[model samples]
Target: MKAIHIDRFVSNVTDLKPSTIPNPFSKSSQDIHIKITHAAVTHVDLLYAQGLHQNNRRHVQPPFILGTEYAGVVTHSPPSSSFPPGTRVFGGGLGAYAEQICVSEPTIRRVPSQWTNAEACAVGASGAVSYGALISVAQLKAGETVVVLGASGGLGVVAVQIAKAVGARVIAVVGGKEKAEVVRGVGADEVVDYRQEGWEARVKALGNGGEGVDVVYDGIGAVESGIRCLRYRGRLVVVGFAARGGKMENLKVNKILLKGVAVFGYRFGEDSRRDPQRTKDVWDGFMNLVEDGKIRPVIYKEDYWGLEAVSRALEDVRERKAWGRAVIRVCEVEEDTTEQKARL
Candidate 1:
């Protein structure tokens, strides 16, 4: 089996290399062996490479497998699990950028027939976060106005479509004109170029006559200038800090007091770990929406880079060149003998 491993803390993109190792899951305690079909490269992967996410890497050692999102077929399953062997599923795991993976039953979810491998891979991390933010954190309601910052990136794109699917009027704040168009295409009612002058004011203008939005889903953090855009009694859900090196601006305590606004900081992984049932419910609801055609995963591109291309894929996501999700085709699974013979 082949996989990509980080030799050391990579300061730049060129530092990554490919290596050959034994198949990761062949010796695992779990019953299922997943032939990893697709693995999505994410900004989080880059952060890990640069040592920016050191706190997160504390438990995991070096020469570690880096990807978190994957979709593939199950070659085996424990009797206690609901999924049978040969089932197609998508889910998040600790290390996914390899030829094969062995995941515990609890972390996997069956992929619907209507979804392609690329779409399922794209939804792995971003979709779950968006669902948690909207359904659990904000408790969003129909017809409310929602603002999504960094609306062109992987997670933001999913958030925009999900908000619209829930009947919210969405205002998207993107980095440039090109990204604004991308956000608009994803069903945001209005798009603002946050790089332009007066972009914050423009967001207010689109709101209830310079008042503000009902909910602000800010993933970009500092770059979007989030604090100034909230309405009286508005809810701000902080999802990520994509804008690196930016300062966390102080919020005016009096403003919160006068406006009755609330700020909620969220980390989806923590929520999933603390309340597994809620996380499962969120995924189930999102799956239903995908089946109903109310929300579709926006896949930017697929990079079929055998196992060696993992470094380049991670760099592409880090530099912000990859728009939605950048997926790597890992390995192919052989058809189950019983199923194949039955078809004949």
Candidate 2:
């Protein structure tokens, strides 16, 4: 087994490296063993690696495996569980970058039969968050207009596609032409390059009846500007602050009230235990969109292969040179042991 861990916060991407890890398994009968094949890299992962995220109230130290989401094949599980042995699954698990890890059965979801390993690893985290913001928090209705800030990044790509899948017109906000192209390719109805002059004017001009969009799916810490992009009684779904160094800042309450809109802070996976039905709704919506071919995660594969390339993935995010959400190819998908035994 192999995995990546860091000793301390450092800006150098090359400092994180893969090291040998012993095989880990479930301590109880309810846990399932996963042979990880791919791990998704996010901007939050980069911030934590750099020791810049202030949310670590736990004083989470280093010399720890760095990922929380992964996709893999199940090698061991109790027979009575929903997912038996040999199930292919994707979801959250501690120390997820490792070659093998354990997770409780409820936390993982079955990977769609037609999806690839890389897609599964990337979708579970970002897809759910996007669905929760658009469908749950904002209650976005069909044929409405949505403005997705940071439309080329991980969450932004999903937000754009999800809004489109639900029959909403999507206006994606990116920094440049490169990001605009990517956002458009992912089903955004329109692309607004914030780098250009009067970009907000472009956003405000797209509304049908109101002054601006029906909802703003903001992941870029642009709460101030995103509120202005929303129409009357519209919603601003706050997902992240990657655009502002992962910090949560002040919001203009006056603007929010003046527009007669709502602002909801969405931490999608955080409320799963307390609101299981809501979590299911979001996950089901994402799966439905995926099954219907209306949405699919765009995987970034620049200089990425095996666990060693995790650093390169993070570096790409830091430099803003990556294609989309970075996926580390952890290992080859395991062959069917039953078929192998028959051949033997």
Candidate 3:
């Protein structure tokens, strides 16, 4: 089978190439087999490829497959598994960028007919990360004010929508005017440019006076003013550290202590490993929202076809040129509005 291969760590996207590998599953194996049709390129792809991510249970040393999100049709499944042959499904697994993937049946979720390939792929893990942090972890409540840092990236875009869907007023913090616009288009009540000197203060003012926002969803993982942008007892959920070369910032323990605030670090990979049932529940809930039109994956509408186009797609996401979730179409895209937002 053909799959994406990383020769070594601390490398560039140019180093990523397609390579032939042995098929890990057979017709009677317990694992489910899927022929990937769409894959989402995430910022973590760049971080891990460059040898920078902090949390790695297996201590990935490269010379391995690279990818996490995939959506396609099931080719084989045991009768005990509800996902039958030719079933349309999407989920997260290591080395997901390949043409074929073998994973446990629990890792795959049946894709609803109304969802497009891009939407199904986004729901695999990235969108669930947002839902888990906001709904499951943070316990975000309706009518509360929250701020989403990096509110225009892949995870950030989903965070903004999830917060709004739950009836919370969102103060989206982005890096520039263009990102600000993207946040607003997705239902953010206010957009604050992080580049501005007083962005944190902007977040505070929009909250309930000097108290600040009720929750701070910092996917950027910077203690860079995000710690001070929270209300008294407001929760700070560390979603990720995509900025600063994937290295965590030096956070002030005093801030958490003195502010009487709560700090939590969230990792989707770790959560999936420790709690598969919770992972399924989160994915199912996120997919339900997508089906009901309460939320949709805002995809970066760019033509990415064949495995050969993978590098360009990764580069587009790494360079932040694509606005929303970056997806690679392995087959022909069938519809609009279901997966991707209209490109202007």
Pick the lDDT winner. Answer: 2
Q: Write the per-residue lDDT of candidate 1 for residues 49-103, one digit (tens) a residue.
A: 6767634557455757777788877777776667787777787866777777787
Candidate 3 Cα outliers beyond 4 Å, as residue runs: 55-59, 332-344
The per-prediction CA RMSD against the true structure, in angstroms, equals 3.2, 3.0, 3.7
lDDT of each: 0.75, 0.80, 0.79
Q: For candidate 2, lDDT tens digit of each residue in 37-86?
A: 77888887887777776544454468667777888888888888888777
Q: Model 2 segments beyond 4 Å from truth?
A: 59-63, 301-303, 337-344
TM-score of each predicted structure versus truth: 0.90, 0.92, 0.90
Which one wins by lDDT: 1 or 3?
3
Clashes of each: 0, 0, 0
Candidate 1, superposed: residue stretches over 4 Å from native: 26-30, 54-57, 245-255, 302-304, 332-344
lDDT of 3 by residue, 11-98 (tens): 6786677788887566456788877888888887776676676644365666767887888877778888888876788887677778
- Model 3 gets an lDDT of 0.79
**Candidate 1: lDDT over CA atoms?**
0.75
